[model samples]
Target: MKLVVQVKLLPTPVQAAALAMTLRACNAAAEYTSRVAYERNVKSRNELQKLCYREIKERFGLSAQPAVRVVKKVVDAYTALHSGIRAGTLGGERSRRRVKAESKPIAFRASAAQPFDDRCLSWRHDASTVSIWTVAGRLKDIRFAGSADQLATLRAHRRGESDLLFRDGMWFLIATCEVPEPEVFEPTDWIGVDRGIVNLATTSDVDNFQGRRLRRHRRWHARKRAELQAKQTKSANRLLKKRARKEARHATCVNHRIANDIVAVAQRTGRGIALEELRGIRDRVRLHRHQRATQSSWPFHQLERHIAYKARRVGVPVLLVDARYTSQTCPRCKHTARSNRPTRDTFSCRRCGLAGPADVVAAVNIRDRARRAWALVNVPVSMAA
Candidate 1:
């Protein structure tokens, strides 16, 4: 399994400058590669394109760490759409919603093209430390924030390393670690989660596992965003950039905390988690001033992805089931009857007079649906009846 561990690097002033250059180059390379790959897909086979990219990289000094990853994604998207058309997973033109719209401005960082040691298979650690390449040999003090084993794993990605630079004052040596998949088992505790606008998330099964909403704080950001849109001055733009970075960092930290807390609760309680398979939420969200405040405000999908991976580390499995009727259906009466969830905060059941906080009910039902889907999938049952 591809396990990622981000290690912090504190480089000297010179090293930081070099790193910034590398990051900018990497981002540029990634953008170029993406366009080239998309165009190449029409004229050549995948195998040929790989060889072409390798040759291009060797010819041009564009070896940013993120280039390969980004191009791979672009190629995959292109291929998937084409293949889907041929196989009929979708018909006609690709959906506008499926296209990846970058929430933040597109800029390449030098550390974007960090290479991995292992190919398709093999223990990544034994491949040797290939992630770091020092020019003007023997650099500054950079420490690993993990165990020896973790460091060994990080080396798996950097079989042969390159230096990168960014525009900002920073440098990075991208590294990767391969974590062997742990033996996964069915869990006894079945947990349900409800991800929403009012509150970020709430669990049906875990009493204490509730995710707080970012709406109030996010509203504070909305006003800042408004002032930002009015002026085109460089200073104003720079302030907007600063504010955006701060808000993004804040959102990420909140996601990390919420995800870790959810998994920790599951691990302690010996339960499995179930979350809705939300699709097109970005487009489906109502077009309003508040929703328009930030396109990336909804972090439900990101949090779920994090939770699934982290949960796997400790053998806590997660199930993504159909979200249809999960909110409106009555959990207690098993009623499929529709009811209007007029407000975000309230939850009232029409069939059963089951009145409680709306989030709580939805959370429990989400858990219930998870158990059902798990059974249908024929995966080992994780929930205890």
Candidate 2:
């Protein structure tokens, strides 16, 4: 599996200035390449490089490798844009977002991240420093810090390219690491996880990860954002962005904790994890005005991703089952009806008079479904035929 390890860089003022200048130059060169490609309708990396390489080097004071990286970045942006268009993720042909995207050449932010390969960037794991190429010159002995585990992973599995980025006056390098996955063991049972706005997650075993605290946290941030927007000043806008980032970090931390606990339980019990397939959920559900923000901003997908990666690392199988009727169907009586769920948190079966917490019932149904699905998937091929 491929993962990214990010480390914070501590640089002298002079080194920081050089890093900033280098990043700006790289992005400027990228913008120029994008414009040239847009005007000439060039998409191939080699062809675009041929057209912009010499000028990029001369104008941006970039060396051979940086210039090549700039051109490749432009090519990749176009490729991703075209891919999104083909995938209909941007919207339909006549949609305003799609048309707006197609109407202009792609632009790069001045502080956009730039990729550095081994030729331009070298790591000194023993000294906790890195030497990297900059437009001013080559910078050596720039210090970096990370957790012990992260540093270990970087030293052992770091490969391919690293991205240099500046965020909130801090410098970071995100390096890719390829780790080996353990062999999956036969599962003794399944743990079904039901995701919801109120509870966040509820497992078949009745373990609940509540969202009450997080909801309060978001409401506080929302109130602050509203106040900042009312001010409508440049400083207010900047502060708003800072607050948004802080909120995002908090949410990510919560998700990580929840995922770690769930994966740990699954591994300890020799159980696979089952989750609902929630693709395009936003399109399928209708929401009231007050509920839209809560529904849209919830990090349900992030929690799922964390669970998946952690499970994979520990050799726990994950199953994705259909999400429809999970909340409405009765697990005990097998009765399916909307009336079975009389409220958000309660479930009462219409036919057999079964009752339980809605989230737990849904989770139980998910576990049952996974058992049946896994059996069919792993059945011997020639048993009858």
Candidate 3:
């Protein structure tokens, strides 16, 4: 029922400067606020604690919201320490107060404009007000939502709450939104997914969610990464930062396209999507050098999250089947034998003498699980075994 629809934002140069200034203020405020907490917990300081925010405001000249965020973090740390004590998890006889050279906590500011403003990404509310500003029209495109409805909806879902930060160029908020379990569905078909490093994804619904060719963008990615890293001059660094933002934008766009296509496939199939409950395929595949390298490049988690959310939006369900033995178990013979999976990419059942592509075998098993689950779940309407 609740979900987030994030769109890109476009900002002008002036706005970008303002955003940069805001990030600086937040960073400085974080350093100030955290230092205060570190000092206070080292020893009691009732006087200094009272005026911390005022001092930060006067010194850093940050917006009230960003200042408040810093204050919250400082207070949160002490509260955590206190709770740890009562729970007998913290001891007072701690090591010498070796001060950590405090770096500003990652921070970003939001200068949300009015809803109609084309230059801003705005969200306004009775509960919480938020707006997004962008840099020069060329970069840092953000959305600013400024509507009473927007604010009310934002508050309705807590996971969508975010702590804004400016890192790796453009602004970011660690945000989340809930994927509601669907209440209505056709309940006849099921979408099956096969995850891989090269292809990113491949669902059993005719269209491959992602093709299985190992798209080792290593050279391309490394080239960009190197350009980003090899910044010797100030101007060079600035340019690299800008390029990084562009790269991220490009990647996000591609991901969106892929995710949207997946949702479309499910809708066309007239049922829910089913994926193996692979708890940690990475762990299983991480030992080998090639697999490890491939694993690092694959964004499996992001794809699944996108699928879950996209399914929720379309009023479709996403089913996760227990993946244990799904690869080795023969879809035709129902035999659980290691020989059933002769190779990483091939599945064969020794008992029934069945062999096929490993992923297809896995997809069939997952597809069956989904069909059975759907049939059992909607027994009132579906013909169940």
Candidate maximizing TM-score:
2
TM-score rank, highest first?
A: 2, 1, 3
CA-lDDT, candidates in order: 0.60, 0.95, 0.59
- Candidate 3 regions off by >4 Å? 1-15, 42-49, 62-66, 73-186, 210-214, 222-255, 283-286, 353-355, 373-385
Give per-residue lDDT, candidate 1, residue 207. 56
C-alpha RMSD for every candidate:
7.0, 1.6, 8.1
Q: How big is the positional error of residue 370 in model 3, measured in Å on the Cα after superposition?
A: 2.8
Ten contiguous residues with the weakest lDDT in model 2: 376-385
Q: Per-residue lDDT of 1-385 in model 2, one digit per residue for the tens?
A: 9999999999999999999999999999999999999999998999999999999999999999999999988999999999999999999999999999888899999999999999999999999999999999999999999999999999999999999999999999999999999999899889999999899999999999999998999999999999999999999999999999999999999999999999999999999999999998889888899999898897889999999999998899999999999999988778899999999999999999999999999999999999999998888989725
User: What digit string (tens of lDDT, one per residue) describes model 1 on residues 45-80?
Assistant: 455356446744664454433335445544555566
Q: Which stretches of candidate 2 lie over 4 Å from their true place?
A: none
TM-scores, all candidates, are: 0.67, 0.96, 0.64
Residues 1-385, candidate 3: write the lDDT tens digits. Answer: 5565342223456665766665556566656766666655432334434658678768877444445555665565556655665665543444232122122232223332111122233343342335653222222324444345434445555353454444544544433446456555775687777766544566665355443323544457657768767777788777777775665565556666787887787787677788877666656643767556556655567777877877786777788987777778887769898777777877768898888777767777888888887777768744543
- In candidate 3, position 264 carries an lDDT of 82
Q: In candidate 2, how many Å is residue 53 off?
A: 1.2
* Total clashing pairs in model 2: 0
